[model samples]
Target chain A: MIKNVYDDEVPKVVTIKETVIETPTVKTFIFPFEITEDIHPGQFVMVWDLNNEKPMTISVIDKKNNLMGITVRKAGPFTENMYENMGVGDKIGIRGPYGHGYELSGYKKVLAVGGGSGIASLAPLLSFYDNVDLISAASTKDELVFVEKFKKENIQVHECTDDGSYGFKGFSTELADELLKTGDYDIIVGCGPEIMSYKLLELSQKYDIDCQLALDRYMKCGLGICGQCCIDDTGYRVCVEGPVFDKEQLGQLSEFGKYRRDAAGSIVEY
Target chain B: MLKSNILGMNLKNPLFLAAGILGTTASSMKMVARAGAGGIVTKSFSLEANDGYENPTIVKIEGGVINSVGLASPGVEAKKEELIELEDIRDETPVIASIYGDSEDVFCEVAQRTKDYVDAFELNVSCPHAKCGFGSNIGEDPEMTYNIVSSVKDSIKDVPIIVKLTPNVTDITEIAKASQEAGADALTLINSVGPGLRIDYQTGKPILNNVLGGIAGPMIKPIALKCVYNTYKTVDIPIFGVGGIKDYKDVLEFMYAGASLLQIGTSIMYDGPEIFKNITDDLSIFLEENGYNNVTEIIGLSHEL
Candidate 1:
């Protein structure tokens, strides 16, 4: 048997830190793990209360802040517990700075795109670079929370909303695709809904925009052992090899931007 | 402590890491050893290279993982390089080469090629997730299981042969008896259960591309223990128990169920390589506290009643 380092147990707590609630569905829980002294952008930490099964993917927003936080959506049992029960002073279990992050260098101008809760994963990538353009879309203005953070960093911000309650009247993919076709970018980095990321990749491929996507999947074991968070066909375990992959590579995976499974191996409809 | 001989090979402890979880590479096998495992078993490799299944080969159900790795391997020749690397790290820690194939010749050839590098050979004729031509088709039939095991036994020398059996049978003892009748040395009871699959709710698609996978981890622990307990009544050879063993307590249960040794597979994924050390340390304490003289005394202890 191959030796797996991280298993399904709770990891030792490094530190319980805090961040402000930028919005109701998106509050950043800051945790500083002494175990992870050196973590890079695009790497994420799994956070969930011991009483719950839902794991939050907290992006390493500020490695220097000693306060890496995850922005969560009130979706299910785990998140509900995290939201209703968790506090700024409460300590929760954290495992990983796991998964592959975005490829950032060797580009003249790049675009970082996000949708809703997906913005939490892109924060570090945007914070690490100053020359990049930050394009984001949400359901409404109230859902648009990270604009000030992007503006504070002096990163170009393109905001869009579905109901015209914010910036553009359409989706972020539309705005991203238009700018992508100008042949002005070397790479486009994205994370959010699968359809959104998939659409971004589709446009990038059509317009020949080099792109990388931060994938999201359920990870029961932070190490590659559990096989719960496997991506399609590549036989690549997201917890060990990557949560990031090139768009050209993404096209080859059979279950990219997909959901969880039922007993019969069929995709469960939401 | 359980200081016992499996197939005439000495094991400091009877606890081993089972095949397939992290056994694909030499590094992974070495890591399990460093974590206090007495032995290692490589992922099931075949004579030819197989890609296995795509991502989501494993999925989390309530109690275990459903894996359909498709027996992904780099084939025999490439696997030899990994076995050679294992030779450098060779110590009292035994690395059991687990091999599977479509025919008896294929099994013998693989056994012959790596016999010198490994401490023992585990014939994987019972992988539940393997396709139509693979896995249990050859294993379920007593005659075929006996023939394939006999072929490898006839070809390979020195290294003891262990046949890993599937639990998806009506009478596992019959299979064990047949394998022993064909000259098998030792047996590893239970691979995964079911050609199981998981589905994605939103996309209305199967979670794994292969559609069906082997059920492993904690989910099948009860069934595996039953198989070991039942097989012990019929077979005299040592049995290596594998299923969902999370700690030393689980290992003890396997021993009570008639397993001379136990292996940790899916548990490694959840707990990391430290599981070996963690369980060993805990077992030492349990042994001392419980006033047990040795681990061997517990083997089939429950059957005495």
Candidate 2:
């Protein structure tokens, strides 16, 4: 059974029950114990690979079987270490189910957009909401993940590949724009590259649709004190106030798609 | 219950959110106030926007974390927006703008630009990891520290000027005396300590991108207490004690060590914004248990020995 970590700040050692290789870079590590807290869609947990603690979204939460899962892409040092060395039964520290998740209760029809590894974050949302139009995009056909999982659940899925290897030969935002014109979606939820989310923000405004975008930023302490995850000029902390933000809130951010601060707090082109 | 006054600004308590930790935005600043800080010091800003450094700016070590954020700021004009938001909360929580610059004139310019939106100015001459000739470089030299503080004091009228001092020096009181002589209304003791480093065993490279950064957290608490304890003897102005402060016990220690106000930074990372209220509540209980009616009764009590 996976050990449950009680504290928000302290890490609890949990045994990895299974590891599923989703793609070349992305993998899902499942834990045996249930996180008793109600982890909403778009919420994340800080995983400690012993080298460093990093934030990752909850890709799967199985309460009945007492299991939890997180999908990770080998994007940085910490994730790369996990991909290369970690295996089932390997004990890794996990803390928190932090941040406000997607508020998907009132919406009748919804559109979900996921880009690259962002599909993992969208998976839980698709599971919770029945009427979701899912768009999964990747750089290549093989890189596209969770296509079969969505199909198995009988959810309608749209695929997009930047290299034109799959369903649509364009960006996910472009596909979302095309879908927005025809489908009447009450709310659009997205998690991906900043540029895509920024574009989605624009399209949401253009289409007059309510949208929520899950944002990523450099975070230290997930509990809102470390200002590392702050958005430019606006001062909203992605760790606390977001990681998931509605269209109106994202509009106020000046650095949305244009820039992001590095770990050193240096602004770099996103 | 723990009301205190420092530099003519009234405070509900001695606790403040230190600059450069979580003071970047007005919303976060207001959150800190709502969480129970007597005042909020903004993340240090300059005359122009600075990108700071690259990735791996802050690394957590055993005792604390080392950060070389390089003072990344949105410049004063952009920072004014956050300051304006802070103005709405100024009545509940006083706002202090922490400003840093390369020269005395630049410091004066930033002070002039931001003076209207804040209750006071904290001259940041003590950040150990900032670019050369800006942070500790200006602070380490008595004459330079005097020049910067006096220049800022001259440029701004009616606003209290607080000099934030570095602990890297051999004699902190020397610098503290210099700041007092130069007309500083108050002082915040000890920025982070050392251009510290943490090397990754597998990579065999420094963990921080800047190679070296200032250390803040539990490791520096003793040093900060000592700096405040000693500097209180040298300067008559109020001292804002900061460094590794975590709980109500640390608050009492700082108060006994002669700090009129306490600034919390690294602890906020571990405990979150609620730490202010937690510490304040616990402190109130400790004071009542000890039969102390006012927090000032214990200020500098250790010096009597």
Candidate 3:
């Protein structure tokens, strides 16, 4: 695939154009971005809000409007700061669109699944391609991100929430497994919890279907020099080689579903 | 002819990925090894876990970056897994563990734990921004430098010791000589040059969480060359040059200044890991064209002149 590589370590100041409350826990912050690099879905940027910096996947890529958006889940200190003080007209810095994005061509049918805020990375795929369906999962109905927008786009939406407060009760992989039984798909795209991706990977292997999974790990230098985001086994930097990996690539990672390193590089099993 | 065997490690070339940038994991170190680095230096770790600084640990300036990662280490226990992974590639690429401590006891303890995996240990006594007397506090003093070097060098079995010295001192050669006397196998000339600070014009505040960070990149090359050149003349051991090496030309200058082994850091921040292959390939082309037999012939050319 002809992927766009937009990576600059120097932080570029950008004004916040708007912010959308996707859910109670998630928000999509829109900003005016010069689309110089031919970027695609699943590529992320390091967002610097003056006080702190964190990696956020590009959720909205509106080329015509010259605008971009990042959907953030307010889970940690960085996100908490954004929710409390950041808004329209507030200036922030972005330095990448780092790592390889999902490859969209040469596939007839695709099943894209996202859990909670993980759907943000897959949101752009809906607009980038055709004949692709989505499995949007979260803990509760209010927690499902980008569902209304996906519904507006008239694409197939399979909603699954763990609390049975939304669509299919239980895990997103369970819903995906049932869907695989019901229909045949060329590729299954997953982004969310590592456990869900692991289960989906097993399902893909079981049904003999190809898959792509996006990974989110503790990273320091989103530029790939820190080695904080490097996965075990292949030693591939998640910042460069992936945040998204195919079924074959995902299989090479021993730490994919089992465990990951904390901020201090200590092993923490999932 | 770019290959060299130094201090028990067979190097495929004279180029290595410096510590603190991308040396956090075994997988990452292996990635660098596959990318064509002669050796790999794991990021500095200690006896206990340290969170380091908060956000804004690194920032870019004109010539290079000012970073105070605060020597964030996962501790010896956690980092041992990464060091152990390096054993698989010990033949093709030797692994160097860059370690730090507030005293000689912690230094020996950390090396003792992970000594089995790494081929050598690069003492990180030169980090200008490390807090609580952990880094430069010991390096600046000749006695402390000798004490730590001797303590760790004496305790670790079969592993060579390379002392990384800071240029932010009255005379680096004194520390270099002390390290050599204390049984250091080699010396790494000049860690980051400054405890520099960058204040954002927009916010009127410091860019780094620690307020001050070490300076690295092309800006510190001349100083690094001076240190390498001076130390090479004083000490009997070899020198590892590390400061703002961006391209083959930079590596060439470092070797000429008396650095037998070279490390590439800060530049790898913006440039990809491919920098290793690019620099090595270009160095090879330069060597072939210049009619030099190998990389070893060029060491200390400036000093001879």
What docking grade applies to model 2? incorrect
Docking class of 1: incorrect
Interface RMSD of each: 11.1, 6.7, 4.5
lDDT for model 3, on a 0 to 1 scale? 0.86
Candidate 2 per-residue lDDT over residues A112-223, each given as its tens digit: 8999989888888765777888899999999998877777877778999999999999999999989989988878899998888888888888888898999998776575
Contacts from the true interface found in each model, as a fraction, amount to 0.07, 0.18, 0.50
Give the alpha carbon lDDT tens digit for every residue of B152-211 in model 2.
Answer: 878887999999999999999999998999899999998999978866543455655577
Q: What order do candidates take by DockQ, descending?
A: 3, 2, 1
In model 3, how many backbone clashes occur? 2
lDDT (0-100) at residue A40 of candidate 2?
A: 80
Higher-DockQ candidate of 2 and 3:
3
Whichever of 1 and 2 has more DockQ, that candidate is: 2
List residue ranges in candidate 2 displaced over 4 A.
Answer: A1-112, A123-134, A137-156, A160-189, A193-213, A218-223, A231-236, A245-270
Candidate 3 residues lying further than 4 Å off, grouped into runs, are A1-8, A151-156
User: Could you list the CA RMSD of all candidates, in the order they appear?
Assistant: 12.7, 6.3, 2.9
> Candidate 1's residue-wise lDDT over A89-137, tens digit each?
6766555667677777788888888888787777776656766787778
The models' CA-based lDDT, in order, is 0.75, 0.83, 0.86
Over B95-172, each residue of candidate 3 has an lDDT whose tens digit, in order, gives 899999998899998988888888899999999999868899889999989999998877986899999999999999
Ranking by lDDT: 3, 2, 1
